[model samples]
Target chain A: MASYKELPKTAQIRLVSSHEEVYEPCDDSFALVDALLADRTKLLEHRPMLCMEIGCGSGYVITSLALILGQEGSGVNYIATDINPHAVRVTHETLEAHGVSAELIVTDIASGLEKRLAGLVDVMIVNPPYVPTPEDEVGAEGITASWAGGENGRSVIDRILPIADRLLSEKGWLYMVTLTANNPSEICLEMKKKGYASKIVVQRSTEEENLHIIKFWRDFDNEVDEINNQSTFMGSLLSQIPPFSFWRGNNGNDSDKNKC
Target chain B: MRLLTHNMLSSNIRGVVNGFPLRIEAGKVVEKNVEINGDFLKNMFVKIDWKAFVEASQSMGYTELPEEADSSMLDSDEFLNRFHHALLELHLEEGALVCPETGRRFPVSKGIPNMLLHEDEV
Candidate 1:
């Protein structure tokens, strides 16, 4: 059987460093990586020159991406940013242990990079602070900043969408994790207004939350940007997305939990 | 951070019209050898701000990159190697990226640049 070198590798949990204040890779993080794994073939073919991650907590998803795409002279560049300084250090250690590297930066939603990297990022991934909490809790110090997503868990996601639209090239693709409470359908409609198409790549539910890993790409074919048709578009998009029941594991279990 | 990262960063304080090419103040510079890919360098050539890249490299004590570069130089093996070194190899282990317009200093420690703006600037 094909094994070892023939299979793509991911960061080992044993080697992944952690800090008390940093958000460790959790269910959402695993769900995001699983989505990346599902789209591995397309990503390799995309051959993105620059791939970036916003809120790269514990470095799991970004490091996993580097490994999935291969490392030696693959010509892919990676950049990751986090608002938390401790998260940056932990991510650095995790990448080092895995023999992968990214230009790690401490920034709030790519603040300093917009002018230079405008319309340049080919691939962007974000597992934002998606847990609904008080608005004041959003962007708080330490681990709270990692999960205190304000009001419908969209304070951060709303901010990122515009930045992603501005930074992404015409061919750019974005992968993001969203919770049901975050009103993902509404988010997709928001992106449709920006002339991007969305697809649900993976859907999983835990006891506490149901997560959907959504992928978005600039769709010139989807030029139906008339504001009046948003409800109709949202209705059609929701229908096309497979119900969570259909995606449940063969034994009716959540497969993602095993990986965690 | 490497010069490549420096080339892609600016002091983004609010109302700052010009933040491109944040001047580098090198405190500690280190080099970590990495395999270079010619195709990647060629692709990056078109996107990089050449003047900013060269000056950032010079700040890190890398003077090999020519003051001017065009896609034509990609064919030269010598030029590619120098370009690769200056772009990816040299790291500003400890430094600050100073804003061109506001003159605000964003510190870089352990090769990670802190580019988050202060509340007033934001």
Candidate 2:
């Protein structure tokens, strides 16, 4: 069974849709929640925080975070928005059910952001469309807005970047998730061009996909030891494989092969 | 709406060549409790683009999905419950669906879609 956690006082409230139909929260949100909870010391120091969740569908992250924060004695104000009105309504219902309060809006991030929310965001979290291939487009209504990352899976992110820059506080943080398909390195480089330094804070690989969560911070240690260790181990293992084995001309040593 | 629907939607009502990526302008999004149909969901799993599904559902504020979903997990009650929630429950209420191409907006109210275009647009 899935368990719920309370968001800390210094933490920003999460906004997610509880309506299971139109919007279902992804696992990354849980991972993020867990990470934040694990690092409560750091998060709590940033008191009176405000967060904006772009493309908040059913209110999974926002609601969960709000409940968690309320329990943790932190007062968090969250603004969750989506282009779909239904998404916004569903999110509102979810928050109400949990006795958490959040401001929900239905608007296109590509067009612009709500004025009232301007320059008040301490953190901006986004999980934009990042599918890479044309063949990746599947379901109709869901896929249209969900995937279809324009030409290079950067369409939506590109549009959101400017808004994030504008909405974020001078020392605010941007937490976003993107796929390997989006070429995270390139995206991070682009963000640097916008005067922000970005780094991959977390990454996990599955059989079919590579998931990455990037954080753009004003000053953060980019040295990720765990990721580096994992990469090195994987590299060494691959090098030992038959395909990567050093090939010295088949020494006429048939007996040497059998001895091993 | 399914990702497939979004892919095929275009603003080509008449001369609008930018007919791709039809947005969901939901008005009355609802969650209904439906019987779990694992077989159907499992079969359709392959057809689904998991990333798109995750992103779409997450955008609506849901993030309870598994990182890597496999059809084999469909037999488990835990997996089925999540699948059922994601596949059958969410509904769009009222809003305008936009076309990524021509910047066309389709009005949606009371869970119904209004894809009609202007006479000249057609």
Candidate 3:
């Protein structure tokens, strides 16, 4: 007998429509979906009223999100935006195939709707253009927009962070995919400055690259870390610097400080 | 295009600000019956733009929806079914969405409205 209580699954490929110019669901996309699944319990409890996706590609991530949060959260509204018009059409067919739906827009990330949707999104997701390329290639036409990230793959990612911050509600949650080459820790540090707490929800190493799905949310207590950092910066550096063997022999509390 | 999709669409052409509620000139409208799910309809009510919805419905010859969404009608199964029929079942098969500011016509064919702007217009 089938289990009466089964976990929701991502949208099947049969339901995912495609086009030549659109980016299909790949390792990065699946990793993003996995991050969402890992956080599903918190998500359902969050009861997000509005969910938005930037750079939707073939609609895989948004569709997976909607399906994973199915009936219990039918009230959730989904809107997906892509710079590629072809992606918008493919997403339409994909959503229709699964008997689910979202408002599809073709434009730069949430361009026209920025004013209307400002600070209204409860959940936002992105598997951005993170492949290193020339700055000119970052937002190029058609398929190039799918994976062309210029100079450390931060061009598109940098533009998206501010927009995500502007669109996210006070309690909003954001999940984004980043490559190891993109410098994940520095990205986290940058978000820390913006008062967002982040963690690597999913990390996968494939032949091509190391992918990290980072989840960030508003941290009201972020200032606490800042205060602690100010007081402990020198102490932390002493623990990290050379002469560790001598310092350890001299200080009995070396292990205690190193624990951090 | 379903009214649900229509509600969120706005013209993004350069220099044309406030492209919402694009004027819909319906050439053809198709209505097909779909399963009635009360919960979905109830949830969609709050997210929907009542004024744009009412205007678009009236344009497609759907006069069942009231000028304003009534909270009292949510619990009624009959009203839920009606709302579902108007929103999910009705499709704008062929039409032209005229940009409010720029007066550009975006053609809707086979129930898909092309909102793609030209290179310079983007």
Residue-level lDDT tens digits of model 1 in A1-260: 56776876777789899999888888889888899989989999998888999999899999999888865389988999999999999999999999999999999989989878988888899999876666887898887788877786789999999999999988999999987777788888899889988999888877767888999999886585556666777788788554333222223232321222
Tell me model 1's lDDT, rounded to 2 decimals: 0.86
Report the error of model 1 at residue B81, Å: 0.9
Chain B TM-scores of the candidates: 0.97, 0.68, 0.93
Q: What DockQ results for candidate 3?
A: 0.26
Lowest-lDDT window of 10 residues in candidate 1 chain A?
Answer: A250-259
Which candidate should be chosen as best, given TM-score against the real structure?
1
How displaced is residue A73 in candidate 1, in Å? 0.9
Cα error, residue B100 of model 3, in Å, equals 1.1
Candidate 3 per-residue C-alpha lDDT over A1-260 given as tens digits, one digit per residue, 9 for 90 to 100? 25633846787887899998888898899899989999999999998867989988888888899887763235676788888888988888887787676767666887666654667788999998887666787778878788877777789899899889888988999999987667666676677678787777888876656678888898897566765664353344233232212111112232221111
**Residue-wise lDDT of candidate 3 within B48-99, one digit each (tens)?**
7889888888888899987876777998887887788777778888888888
Specify the CAPRI tier of model 3.
acceptable
Report how large a share of the reference interface contacts model 3 reproduces.
Answer: 0.18
Tell me which of candidates 1 and 2 scores higher on TM-score: 1
Q: How far is candidate 1 from the true structure (C-alpha RMSD, Å)?
A: 4.9
lDDT of 2: 0.55
What C-alpha lDDT, on a 0 to 100 scale, does residue B48 get in candidate 3?
A: 75
